[model samples]
Target: MIIMRKHHFLLSCIIAITAFTDGSQQHRNTEDVSDYFEQIRHDPSSLSAFLTAMPKGADLHHHFSGAIFGETYWNVLTESNGWMQPYTIEVDTAGALHKAPWIHFATLSRESRFDSLKQAFLRKASIKDYDPSAGPSDQHFFSTFSRFGAVARYDMKTGMQEFKQRALAENVSYIETMLGAPDTAIRLAAGPAWEKSITGASLSDSTTVFNTLDQVYAALLKAGIGNTAKKFCHHQDLLHQQAAIDDSVFMLRYQLHGNRNEQPLTVYRKLLIAFQAASMDSLIVGVNLVSPEDGVISMRDYSLHMLMFAHLHRHFPHIRYSLHAGELAAGMVRPELLRYHISQAVLIAGAQRIGHGVDIAHEAASIPLLEVMRERKVAVEINLSSNEFILHVKNDQHPILFYHSHKVPIVISTDDAGVLRTDLTEQYILLATRYPSIHYNDIKAIVRNSIVYSFLQPDLKERKLGQLDSAFIKFENQVMFH
Candidate 1:
């Protein structure tokens, strides 16, 4: 008995020693990699190569339509017999642009004028070669969507496949992309009912507001909105199957979003449909509000939009959402408009995440709000390039470091990568170069936050996290030995 007890103790000690040794070695490896990163941090080319090989966990704030490159949109347009107006480079699927001024893609291709036309189209369709003197950067960035929207939705499968391929190449393991918008028919159908019900009902009166929303909800169901949600799910399933976008190495999920720059009734209907669809579809994980936050309608109906979200949350509490709040700067809107968005998004709308919380510093009770975000684990999606181009917020002026200092979870994302002519790697590069204070382990934690804060199912999230763990082990090994 004494000898057996002694042997058990000896075995326990050996196990402990082995664990400590392995853990210490891992720490050393990470430190060594960090040192190497510091060495090449000043060299752009080498830094790009290093970060490109690093495994990025997920892009939590990606937009599907904005992810497709200009070249891809052009190819889809030309292949589908679309015509482009030479002056504006705007495309029309119908023969609307078939008159003298517009050129057919077939003729351009036949005459070898395709390359020149494509270059011109690229200039207009993306921020490639954009001149700041020509217009406001934000205006240019937002206008690109209209130019490409005619063809952006043509080949959903191909566009998804393109994003997946690009993600895999950049060592991104998962993407929770925002896709789909409110159904126009449903919005129109619910419009009259919503306007009538909400006309006399004060937003502050919860009972009256709730009853009014219920009436609109009933109207939406009568108008076949539920069927619309189901069809949207079915279409997503077909796209996933056709594209084979998910595998052990890469996974994709989607969020249905609504443009907030619409009328109050239209916005509410869209959010309701989005919530209903997300509740019914596993692939559709969450909902978001998109479009320019500084637009007239978005600004005027901002608080009302939060009230709409709050109403839906009471019913579909299981469905999560991330909001594009505080995508604004001081001069972009009235100074007072910037003060309440991020706070209201969290406090009222119960947003699990916030996209482009750039104006956070302007938020009322900013420090307390940061505490709330940290305590509640409301992660912020940091889009370095997009903020720089749109809001001119970058470097020391950017709140990313402030969020980090407050321990608010931050996930770096590519906001309209195609339009910005950048990618996840470039975002990381900017992060590393601009904010050297965010060390290697801190960056790794941020990478993990992308998956942790994602709207993926609990089980799938766990699996992806485990996969990320393995990927990092392999990545760090290469960085160390190679």
Candidate 2:
């Protein structure tokens, strides 16, 4: 026994020494890279090149539909015989439209005379050449989804391939993208169950609320919601198999998200489905609440949605979810509405991570919330371009620095890379350029947070983190030698 103990201690000491040496070398290489960054900090071209080549660990807040470029959507439209209304740029894939103004993309592309028209359609499909005078930036940004939604429906594998290629090019190894949610049928089926159990119940009564949820949950299960979730998982597996997106260098996971703008019952149903799907599929890592936070239904039922999530958490305690809280700006919603979103998302909904969180400064008990986030290790996803474009909150007004100062974890991400016409590298560039206070090591830690805060399973997360470490070592060495 003594010999075995001595042998174990010796092995532990050797491992510890090796780890210390590697960590010390890593620290030196990071400092060297930081020095290089400082030299080219003010040089846009050099900084862009440096950040582009740097290894970004993961994009934890990506939306797959919004990640495909407008050009790619255009190609899908042309190939699928999709029709586009020239003025509105709205596409129809089902050939259901018989209107005079609806034109086929194939016809439009074939004719030289329609060149300017094609350019206009492309611009309308994305934020390219967006004119603020025409409307609010948020409206213009959100409207692009409908215009290209038809094209997005035709090709899932191709869109995923585009995401993989772009991510690998930028040195991003993992993506936990918001792919989709349960079908309309399953979500609508929840309406009857809600009506039966929760319609007139008092929400203030915790017992009643939980009991109502239990009843609703039982009813949904009787309605074959479990089977529905199984089918969703099976379909996901087929799509993943056909796409073959995962490999040694790149990995893709999904978050089945519920739209916050939907009705309370519908949103709850989606959450149930999302949780169920996540439990069954390893690739489906988590659930999220999406859509514009300031929308009428979203704002009205924001607390209710959080409550539903709290309820679902009880049933599926092991499932993880992130909420899109405080995606709103001051003028976008009423002042009172801004105060408790981040707080509620954290304290009430028990979100593992908070998406956007741009309104942290306005959150009631902001200091406490910040401290709790730091203590609980709840990371905030910083979407610089999206926040700037949608909320007009940028630079000094942005709360990224504030979150950092309070010791709250922050992970930089592209909310909608294709829609914003930006990527993870550009987000880092913006972070480094706009906030010089965030040093190279700080930015590196933020990159690490992307993976660390991700909803990936422990074993898979460890593998990805290992991959990220090697990537950083290689990246820093190149920067130092160069």
lDDT digits (tens) for residues 298-396 of candidate 1 = 887777777788889988989999999999998998898889999999998899999999999999789999999999999999999999999999999
TM-score of each: 0.94, 0.92
Model 2 ranges off by over 4 Å: 1-25, 94-99, 184-207
Error of 2 at 404 (Å): 0.7
Off by over 4 Å in 1: 1-16, 94-100, 182-193, 196-208
For candidate 1, the per-residue lDDT at 204 reads 68
> Between which residue pairs do clashes occur in model 2?
none
Q: Model 2 lDDT vs. the true structure?
A: 0.85
Q: Give Cα distance to truth, residue 36, candidate 2, Å.
A: 1.4
| Ten contiguous residues minimizing lDDT sum, candidate 2 | 194-203
Q: Using TM-score as the measure, which candidate wins?
A: 1
